[model samples]
Target: MKHNVILVVLDGLNYQVARHALGHLQAYCDAGRAALYRLDCELPSLSRPLYECILTGVPPIASGVVHNDVVRLSNQRSIFHYARAAGLTTAAAAYHWVSELYNRAPFEAVRDRHTDDADLPIQYGHFYYADHYPDSHLLADAEHLRLRHKPNFLLVHPMNIDDAGHKHGLDSPQYRNSARRADIILADYLQAWLEAGYQVLVTADHGMNTDRSHNGLLPEEREVPLFVLGSAFSLDAAVRPRQTELCGTVCELLGVEHDKPVCRELLK
Candidate 1:
């Protein structure tokens, strides 16, 4: 049987937080393939561009999604577009507009609420808060869709940990606690999908630095995590170390041929 794919993106998450959120992410590492690599550059590691790189298997330059407001030339055409065109039911539950902005084409159903108003307290250079509506609404929506619609391509974006880390710094107890909260939420969501016999892919757009800044392409802002779990892919030693290679890697894992350009360095 063709397996359904769900991609969970934990924004601004770092390796240390993943370790702390071990209970939620460990199974993916234990039962599937996992890896860690330092990102290619420094700060201003914006989320939209980084996620576009992940979804399109190309760099920001090629993807044309460098910032939150920058629109791609192929606006309604992307990896998700390709996925849905091939008959996969695609949907997204994100906490920010960037996900919708970057992967708008593939998602038949997209739901996200903007949290960028200056009136709100800024956490980690972005407008993410621990007890924000985006977090609860997104997770609830994802759970509902997973249970009801059962989309072939489901993507989730959780912003709590990153928000906490940015507001209180990476090593603060709030960051650690937020990580745990994210873990619980993720574990519950994964368990629901697992019980339903669906394949799951967990990763992040980029890692956060101790300094709580990502304006450039520093190693911390570039390095991210990739964990694939489910009956389709096995946990083996075939994992390779590649930063900025997530887009191509995801395409390969999904058995989808990306007609568009991919980062050659990642494939190498």
Candidate 2:
């Protein structure tokens, strides 16, 4: 079974950025499945709600984490909580609002509010931070966690490219360059993991629009990539084209029985 799952959420990443970073992402695509889909939601695509939904395998309202400031009303356990319950060690590296919402004081190790140099480690549970983009330092830290502690779940969030894209617009060279850099960083990190015989799952929390404006709910904003690597899983050959589905797809891959009532679909 694919016990060790590494989730990479690139905040505000779009298809254009992905294509620009194609070289870096090639290995991930070649190694496993690459499913692209339209997010199909409203505008102002905020990070907290989307991420929370991804984690809990529930919609934003059910998860109760919508927007950055609005916290979930109840305990509202997440994938991390479920992972812990299942006896899997969980670690996270998030940025911007994800770190603020998920990485609480005692349960997580968080870093950096604006810059991309934040690198913190968690002995157990989850580690989250918001670095501008992917970095060698963060990749090294993840490797250490996997090699030294062997955590079952490790989440890494890279924000620089997304920040640049939002600030400078997606068409700008700055956005393209940032995407390329992120791709390279991801390739290097995955190389290390593969060398260590580790399986990797690379994906995004949501996609961004070149328009450079969002209110947290839109199809473009919600649609994201779901790429997987390693020897355990196989890319559905019939489903070569991009497709969309609820976050429960991830739950299925990890062997976690999702409580929400929904039929599972693959990218076909």
Candidate 3:
């Protein structure tokens, strides 16, 4: 069987935010097809390091990304690398770090220029950044690629939640609204992808805290959601998987070797 996966990362989504604002997201928890867990990403919990950890299945310390100071990915293993080895097409539209790390991601990557960047032209990908790009342009771009390239592993990451949380702590209405908007966005894309025969994973790099900014010892900053909604996973068997176990899961789905002890087949 030709297995496919679509990973959607909602940055800086605290568990409380999801629980309170994302009523739509609760469907995944009730659906037997989904496995939901509250998993701690990594220390620092910054976007750069956490996302690196997520893609590489290694902590920031091991991945050589202790802070947001770095731009490119070094010689390391990532989901994209595994996908390529298995002859699967891959693509992503996310933050600049992603594009910078993989040189347009080795397949196709949009740096997701946000309007928040003050209209600075993206030097890498041709896609221009806009403030409303996440809810509008990003989704359109992802759908276009899905229909055109049919990549086996596609990642769509939206950062509005993070921005909102940073600007107006998680308790603020903006943060709550961002969470709801994120849920709607994910629901729309997930439904479309599932209808077109794709497994979907909704997870986050980090969470927000009482403080307007993230990155601290607080659990809110470290713990994030990890929800897998798919057809291959047995509804009868559910597992609380660690963040590092994702590499093995992807490798298993792609029919490749992933012998890391932290990696395991989480499905039944």
- Each prediction's total of clashing residue pairs, residues at least 3 apart in sequence or on different chains, is 16, 26, 3
In candidate 3 the C-alpha lDDT for residue 227 amounts to 71
TM-score of each predicted structure versus truth: 0.75, 0.75, 0.85
lDDT score for residue 6 of model 2: 77
Candidate 3: segments with Cα more than 4 A from true spot: 104-132, 235-238, 259-265
Q: What is the lDDT of residue 189 in candidate 2?
A: 72
Question: Which portions of model 2 show Cα errors greater than 4 Å?
Answer: 27-44, 71-74, 103-134, 195-197, 216-220, 237-247, 260-268
Per-residue lDDT of 1-268 in model 3, one digit per residue for the tens? Answer: 5578878788888866776677666776676657667777777788878877777777878878788777654456777777766656777766656665554433233324321131111121223233345755666667766786677877777788888888889779998898898888766677778878787777888899878888887888878887777777654334557777666676666565555434344554
Better of 1 and 3 by lDDT: 3
Q: What is the lDDT of candidate 2?
A: 0.55
For model 2, where is the 10-residue window of minimal lDDT? 114-123
- Top-down lDDT ranking: 3, 1, 2
Task: Give candidate 2's TM-score.
Answer: 0.75
Please write out the lDDT profile of model 2 over residues 88-204, one tens digit for every residue: 566665653544444433222333332222132222322335445445565555566567666666777667767776787767787778767777777767777656655565666
C-alpha lDDT of residue 242 in model 1: 47
On lDDT, the leading prediction is 3
Best by TM-score: 3
2 or 3, which is superior by lDDT? 3
